[model samples]
Target: MLCCFALSLVACATVPHTGRKQLNFVSDKQLNSIGAKAYSEILKREPVSENKTLNETVKRVADRIGKVADETDKPGFEWDVRLIDQDIPNAFCLPGGKIIVYKGILPYAKTEAGLAAIIGHEVAHAVARHGAERLSQQMALQGVGAVGSEIFKSTDGKLDEKTRAIIGALGFGATIGVILPYSRTHEFEADRIGQTYMASAGYEPEEAVKLWSRMSAIKKPPIPPWLSTHPADQDRVNKLIESSPDAQKKYQEVRDKIGLGVQLDVLMDQSDRQ
Candidate 1:
C-alpha cells in the first residue's frame, strides 16, 4: 500500500502531447520494446517499400522535420525514417528512432509541410512515450500495479510478439486491450504534441489542420485503419486551427531567424525531385 501510494505521487511526467504534468506509471524501456516488437511483426507480415522515389521523398522530408525538433529544444532523438509501399495512408514513429511512412499518405501529404505534419505527429507519440504511459495507466486503473513492473522487465531491449502479448495481458488484463481500447487519450495527446513537433520542424502548424482536412476526406468504402483509430477529423482540425496562432508565430519567428518561409522548403524541393 505504501509503495503504491509513493508510486502515485512520485511519477511526475511532463506529457509530450500537452506539456502537462501527468501521472505515468509505465517504464520507458517497456514502451520501446513493445513499439519495436509491434513494428517488426507488422513489417514481417507486410512488404515494406522498395520504391526508390518513395524512399527518397520520405527521407528528405524526415530530415527536415527532425531538424525542427532541435530548434525547439527537443534534443537527443536519433531519427531514422523509411517509406513503406503500402496502399494505406499511414505513418508511425517508434521509440528510439524507428519511423515508417506509407505511400498512401503521399497523395494526401502533397507537400513537404504536409509530410512534416504526419511525421511530427508520429514522433511526438514516440518522444512522449505515450504507449508505455498508457499501459502504466491501465495497470493503475485495474489496481494491478505488479503487472506494470512485469511489463517493464520482460519487454525491453528486445522483445517478440509473444512477450508483448504476455506483458499486455498482465497490465491490460487482456491481450486484446491494445487492439480494443486503442488508447484514445493517447491519440489526442499525440495530436497536440504532433502539432508542436511540426511547428518546431519548421512547418506551418496550420498545415496539420489542413492535413486533417484531407484525412477527413478519406474515402468511405474501405475506411482506412488510421481513420478508424484517429479521433474525429474535423474536431481535431478545429482544435489545431484554434491553437495555431501561438504555434504558427513560433514557427514564423524561427524561420525569420534563418531567413526563409519555413526551412521545410528544401525538403519539399527534394521530394518534388523524387
Candidate 2:
C-alpha cells in the first residue's frame, strides 16, 4: 500500500495548457503499446475508406493538426490518421497519435475547418494523456480496495463474503460517481486545447463552435448529463463558443505567417464528383 501510494505521488504530473494535476503512473511506452495494438485490431475489423480524395483530405488536415500538436503539446509522437468506412458520427485519437475518422462524421463536419475541430479535439485528448490518467486512477482505486481487504483480513474478526461484496460495490460506486465526472473535465479541457491547436495549424478556430452547434442539432435521444460519460452537447457548445476568441487570435497569427488554408468545400465536391 505504501509503495503504491509513493509511486502515485512520484508519478503526479500536470496536463499541458490546462495545468491540471493528474495522477498518471502508466508509462508512455506502455500506453502507446496498448494503443497500437488496439488500433491494429480495429483496422483488421473495420474497412478503411476507399474514396481516394476523401482519404487524402483527412490525411492533409490531420497532418496539419498533428504538426501543431507535436510542436506545442506532444513532441515526437508517431502521428498517423486514417479514415474508416463507418457511418458512425464519431472519431478518436489513440495514445500514440493514431487517429481514425468515421465517414459518417464528414457531413456533420461540413468543411475542412469543421473537420479540423473534430480531429484537433480528439488529438487533444491524446496529447493531454487523458487515457493514461484514467487508467492510473482505476489502478489506484483497485490498490486501495486491495489494501482495505488486507487490513480487514489482518483484524481479529473474519470478514464475511457480504462484507467483501460491500467493499467491491463501494469501489464501483466511486468509479461511476467520482471518476466519471473527472472524465467530463478531461473532455472540456480537450475542447479548449483542441481549438488552440486548430488555430495554430492555420484553421479557423470558430469552426469548433459551429461544429458543436451542429452536433447539438443532430437528432438523437438525450442522455442525462450525470449518467453520461461526455458533457451535454449544449454545455460543450457554450464552452467552445466562450473559448474560441482566444483560439481565433492564434489562428490569425498563424494565417498571417502562412497563406490561407485549404478550401474544404471544394475538396469535398471534387471527392463527390470522383
Candidate 3:
C-alpha cells in the first residue's frame, strides 16, 4: 500500500490546456498500442462507410483539426480519421489520433464548423490523455480493493460475510463517487480545449455551443451531470458559450491571416440529409 501510494505520487502529470494534475502511470506508447488493437478490432466488426463524399468531408475537417492539435497539443501523434457506417450519433478519438465519426452525427453537426466542434472535442480527449488517466485511476482503485481484501482475509471470519460484502460495496461506491466527478471534469476541460482547437483551425468556436444545443434538443431524457461520465448537454453548452469569446478572438486572428480556408457549404448540406 505504501509502495502504491509512492508510485502514484511520482506518476502525477499535468493535462494539456487545463494544466490539471492527474495520476498517469500508463505510458503513451502502451496506451496507443492498446488503442490501435481495439480500433482494428472495431473496424473488423463495424462497417466502414464507403460513401466517398462523406469520407472525404470527414477527412477534410479532421485533417484541419489535426493540424491545429498537432501544433498546439500533440505533435507526434499519427492523426487519422475515418467515417463509420453506423447510425449512432457518436464520435471518438483514440490514443495516437485514430478518429472515427458515425454517419448519424452528421445531422446534428450540420456545418463544417459544427463538425469541427465535434472532432475538436474528441481530439481534446486524446490530447489530454484522459483515457490513460482514467485507466490509472482504475488501477489505483483495484490496488485499494486488493489491500482491503487482504486485510479482510486477515480477520479470519471475525466479521460475517454480509459485513464483508457491505465493505466491498462501500469501496465501490467511494470509487464511483470519485471517478465519475473526475470524468465530468475531463469533459469540461475537453470542451474548453476543443473550442480553442476549432478556433485555431479557423472554424467558429461558437458553433460548439450550437452543437450541444442541438444535441440537448434531441435527447428525450437527458442524463443529469452529477450521475453521468459526461456533463449534461446544457452544462456543456453553457461552458462553451462562456469560453467562446476568447476563442472567437483567436478565430478572427486566424481568419484575418488565412482567409477562413475550406468552405464546405455543399458538403454540409449533403451530410445533413444523410
Candidate 4:
C-alpha cells in the first residue's frame, strides 16, 4: 500500500500554464474512449444545428482556440465542434476535444470574441484533463472509505449501525469539504487558462469577463460558495478582472489580432423560425 501511494505521488501530473499538480490515475486512453462514446450518443440524441451561420461561427471559434490548446498542452486531442439547436445556454468540451455549443448561448456570446472565451474555457477543461482528475478523486475517496470499512468491521463481519452512520457522515464531509471545492477550483483554473487561450488565439481576453457579466445578469439567486460546485458569479468575474492584464499582454503579442471579430445575430434565427 505504501509503495502504491509512493508510485502515485511520483506519477502525479502537472497542469500546463497553471502548474497545478493533478492526481489522475485514470488513463487518457480510457477517458477519451468513454468521452467519444458519450459524445456520439449525445450528438445522436440532440438536434445538430443546420444553420450555416451558426455552424460556421462555432466551428471557426472552436478551431482557433483548439489550435492554441494543442500548441500549449500537446494533449494530442482530435478536435471536433458541433452547434446544437437547443434552448439552453450551455456548452461543453468533452475529453479528446469534442465540443458542443447550444443555440441558446448565442445571445450571451454577442460576438466572435465572446464565443472564443466560452470555447476557450471549455477546451481548457478538456486539455487540463479535469474530468479524469475528478474521477480519480472520487475513486480515491471511495477506496479510502472501503479500506476504513474493512478495518473497522465488527467481529460479526459487518459494520454496526453506528459505524455505518459514521462512515456516511465522513463521506458527506468529504463531499462538502473536498469535492465541491475542487470542482470550483477546476472552474476557476479553466477561466484563467481560457483567457490565455483566447488571447493567444488573437481574441481579446476582456471578452471573457464581459461574457460572464452578461450571463450573471440573468443568473438565478446565489448559493453559498462552500456548498456549491461552482463559485459565485460575482467572484468569478472579479477573478477574471484580476487576471485580465496578463491575458492582455498575450493578446498584444499576437501579430494578427482579430479583436472582437463579427457580431452574432441570434435575431436572424428567430426571424427564420417565424
What TM-score fits each model? 0.73, 0.77, 0.76, 0.77
Between prediction 3 and prediction 4, the one with superior TM-score is 4
Would you list the C-alpha lDDT of every candidate in the order shown? 0.61, 0.71, 0.69, 0.71
Model 3, C-alpha of 115: deviation from truth (Å): 0.9
lDDT, candidate 1, 11-46, per-residue tens: 657764367665566666555555555556556656
Q: For model 4, what is the error of residue 189's alpha carbon versus the real structure, in angstroms, after optimal superposition? A: 0.5
TM-score computed on alpha carbons, candidate 3: 0.76
Model 3 alpha-carbon drift over 4 Å, by segment: 1-8, 144-182, 221-231, 256-274
RMSD in angstroms, candidate 4?
Answer: 8.7
TM-score of 1: 0.73
Off by over 4 Å in 2: 1-8, 144-182, 222-229, 256-273
Q: Residue 252 lDDT in model 4?
A: 89
